[model samples]
Target: MSLNFHTMHDKNPDIVASLARLHEHHFGARPTVITGLQGDGSDRQIFRLSSDANEPVIGIYGPNRRENEAFISFSRALHQHAIPVPIIYTYDADAHIYLESDLGDVTLLEWSNQHDDSSSVLTMYRQVISWLPKVQLTSKDSIDYTKCHPFAAFRREAMQFDLDYFQSSFLSRFLRIRLDNAALANDFNLLIAHLLRAPFDAFMYRDFQSKNIMICNEQPFFIDYQSGRKGALQYDVASLLFDANVNLSHSFREAMLEFYIRETMRYIPIQEKKFLTFYYDFALLRMLQALAAFSFLVFQKGKSYFMKSIPNALQNIAFLLTQDDCMLRRLPELRRLFEEDVLNNPQALS
Candidate 1:
């Protein structure tokens, strides 16, 4: 006798099918195809769903539901404040799929890269920087920090996270060098303590760089701001100026800093000297965090794209190391390790 067995159907929901459904609901029909866009550090998968009926919309499929929630909530809050973030259209809370306005393919970095004119590039940068103070200071009282991803503020814990992350991902994994951990810890504590005292009340765009700012319709629009939270005002500016991938010139960076200070004064009272002092300290911290992320991507995760950024990140660190008045000079062992194991080693170019 011949016997046949019946197969059981799977219960798990199809995310692509859900996304298609969402497209249909929004666009009157499902898109012909969903093309994926290149992503940054996050694990979120982004798709551009397009059809003839309407403009294309961006579909975001993120693994972490809470992270997606944070972004959606934050985007709503920012939009409510009249900030230039992409307008989020719909969200399927259960499926962790969300749709938002497609801000086009060009980032500020891409736009700047196409131009050979320094004046035009600097103007573009100034335009973008002008929007920052609005994000930081405008509608200042309404934001709910609890909606911020991972944490509410860049407090001591946050600083320590960057320092420890650098130690693990760069110092230990990439360089394969041993250092005086106790001494480094003391230095870390000092740096954190110093940074913690900077103006921590502003909305810091934790990773504010050219790549995160999109250029659409000849205007600057911000993106990738899910990591934003309460932190020192100087950190975001530092991140943009010291961005390893962008490799902004020292003189250009200083010019932008001065412009930022002048713009900042219009919104709030600021002592230029004090802000500059804190700015250098924050710049050092941002460089360390960036190096950690680059090393983590290149060495630990085997992503070669980040390898190109290593030299510039190290150069920024070297520049900071030379600053006689910077807090980084106090950390002798940390300085020595970066100099000997990282700067001196030709293998770092790999």
Candidate 2:
């Protein structure tokens, strides 16, 4: 999964020269700097290219060519539907290099952190909520799900992927917690069946969170939507509200859920009561997936910032665990293991 991008290493003269050539060919001038940007969990290498003559552009070098293609194709579809995404100026499929409009450095997460006022935060969150339904409902007929990376739908198989990711990456690798594999599998099956029963009619922004949202001129522009797929409506909302890094307040989360329900009704008819009922189910599942990712990144990958999020993720899981209506409660063995391995042993996580 090696990337073919340039950075500030003096030893790699060839890499640097190649990047300069790319900048000159694209923007008519060699970039003054091709600074590498910090990455999350993905294997992709992102660089910010800037020059005196040309406006700033982002040059992305991803190892997986298919994922890059997914982003380019999906972004174009979103742009066509008037959704805000970084405009893909050019992409080289053979090299897996992508050059796109630079949406600037401010993410919704960073922007929200700068403001302490609760009302202001809510206002920003509300704006984000308003646009989600549009992303899910708009261009419903036109999107080619085949272009979605990995899969087209968040179906049972896709749900299983997250479950398996948690089991192998977190439970086994990070926590070193052995489990009754059969029991856990049974529980996973039940949970998947329940989620599959939810309304699966909209385009789910698989990773709809504050960090992936860029604030360009105070307006939200979506990025990193390569994982977009057809899935249950509640999953996206859950991802937004229960985001580990953001950790939005409980009251605000409730308000946003209602806002999403109301906003979504504008585009399609939904049973508010039913949607509300299934929201927590999705939220709980999303929390599991997120924690699994956090565990892998923090523990296995040795990325320390993700460790700070463990407490928040655990807190969210604890809250869900206490709820009598929780679908996860049905799996007693899994519950006991999680309670002992994760919830009860908070000292180790810290």
Candidate 3:
């Protein structure tokens, strides 16, 4: 789990040197050392490279070639839209090195956890949503999805997030569950199919959540946004509001969702009824996605940090399933599994 940038630099000394030189050229001081190693879900190693005279620290990322290009392209697109993401100073596509602005250490999650009152936190979160439409519409026209790895190309990789990993590896193997119901298995497969086919035409911050968002100088700044893509807008909203990691209350989640809908209307031409429907559908899809992810964390990764969230995750899933009879009927076994196994036997689910 420990990220070693020194080792990464050793593998690509030339690229590292080029980054250091770029940092010096941009900031008028050579970087002191690379720091910070707690980033998740990325093969890239993020580092805060220091400079003299209170210079803005530079972020260096070591990733594969395609992601490097996407990061560069996406960063430029966001910048053009006046979105508060980091500014890229330099990039070496071949070496997969990215030199960019450092937004500092105080993430939205850290700020919310530190304060007693979340009123200010909520305000900043709303501001982030205010900026979302600009990011979505502007970025939609700027970046080319064909330039990066396509979602269709990731079909096999996406399946890793489905029952194959969750049930076979995590549940059956790690949780030691001897699942008796074949119907439950069928429903789970159906749910996965439905999600994989969900419309993905908008520019999406694939990992939009509190942790990747920073509150610097009282303004919300986006970080770890390189995984952004052309995906459902509701997917990003669900990622933020229903975030299991930060654990915001239901009241606050509702308030934020309302804010998003109202604000999104100002930019997009969608009707209120259609938008509301999409919101509920996306919420259900996201909750089911989280359930699968939580299952993986507990059963495969052995991360107990997600155990407490399972009940709430199942509750959200249940709430969403109730919205659509087709979804409910199609995934009836999943509904039963949630009620009988998850809702009733919280201890077992945990």
Candidate 4:
């Protein structure tokens, strides 16, 4: 499971020379500064490259060629639809290097933290909600699904992958919970069926959380959407609304989910009752997916910073489980296991 990308020091000759060439070609002058940016949990390398005369630009060295290609292609498609994604300036596929427009350092999470007032945060969220439909619905028919990484759409197999990962990585390895594979598979089937009931002919931003949202020029610009594909609209909504670390209030989630519904109505017709039912189910499924991912990055990828979210993810799961009438309440064995670990151990999801 080695990610196929090489990491280099800032002064590494090959990296500097390659980025210098891209900067020289795109900016008409060699970059005078090549400052490395703070890295993320992933293996990708990022830098801010610029000259005194030109605006700063981002330089990326991705580990997986296919993932890079998926992102580059998706960026081009979304930009054509006037989405505020970074414009790809130039790239060298062989070198795994690409340059993009610099969207300064502010993320929506950071922005929200700066504005402590709930009203201000709500306003910013409304602004972001305004764009969610455009990203999910408007560009659905225009983009090529073939270029989507891993899967062209969120299907049964994709849903199963999350459950399987949760069992193997999170439940067994982290929580050390012995699971009944046959019984859990039945619950998995019900979960997948519940999720697929929603209309899914829209673009799904696979990682639409606050961290991927860049607040530039007083507006939100989306990034890290190389994982986009056709899927249920509720999935991305669930991702943002129940994001593990954010801890949005119950009232805020209610208001925002309503705001989202209104905005989404402008694009497509949806039944309120059915959508809400599916939304909560998707939220549960999303929490499981988050736990799976956080554990994967921490254990398999060796990105220990990912552990920061495990507690909140477990909290979200606990809150979701409190609904006595939800889909998860039907799966007794699996539900018991989650409750045992989460309730017994306050931190680290036990």
Highest-TM-score candidate? 4
Q: lDDT score, residue 280, model 3?
A: 60
Candidate 1 residues 1-350, lDDT tens each?
11111120221226656777887887687677566677777677777777767888888888888778777877887898888998999999888899999999999889999989999999999999988888887745666788777888999888898899999988888877787899889889888888777778898878899889999998999888888788888999999999887878889999999998889889999998888778888999998999889888876667788888888888888888888757888877777777777888886755
lDDT of each: 0.82, 0.82, 0.66, 0.84
For model 2, residues 181-299, the per-residue Cα lDDT tens digits are: 99899988988888888888898889998889998888889988889899889999998998888877778888999899999999999998778667887888888788789888877
Which 10-residue window of candidate 2 scores lowest in summed lDDT? Answer: 1-10
CA RMSD of all predictions: 5.8, 3.3, 4.8, 4.1
Q: For candidate 3, lDDT tens digit of each residue in 1-350?
A: 11224435333455556667666776677776655445544456566676554465665666577767776778888888788988888776665667777777888888888877778778778898887767766678787676554342223255335445456543454446567557756766665566556545678776687778888888999876566767666778877887766666778888988888788777776565555545665565556556666666665556777777777666666566556633653566656655565556646445
Which structure is stronger by lDDT: 3 or 4? 4
Clashes by residue pair, model 4: none
TM-score of each: 0.93, 0.93, 0.79, 0.94
Candidate 2 or 4, higher lDDT? Answer: 4
lDDT against true structure, model 2: 0.82
Model 3 quality (TM-score): 0.79
User: Which candidate do you rate higher for TM-score, 1 or 4?
Assistant: 4
* Residue pairs of candidate 3 with colliding backbone atoms: none
- The numbered model that scores best in lDDT is 4
The candidate 4 region of ten consecutive residues with least summed lDDT is 1-10
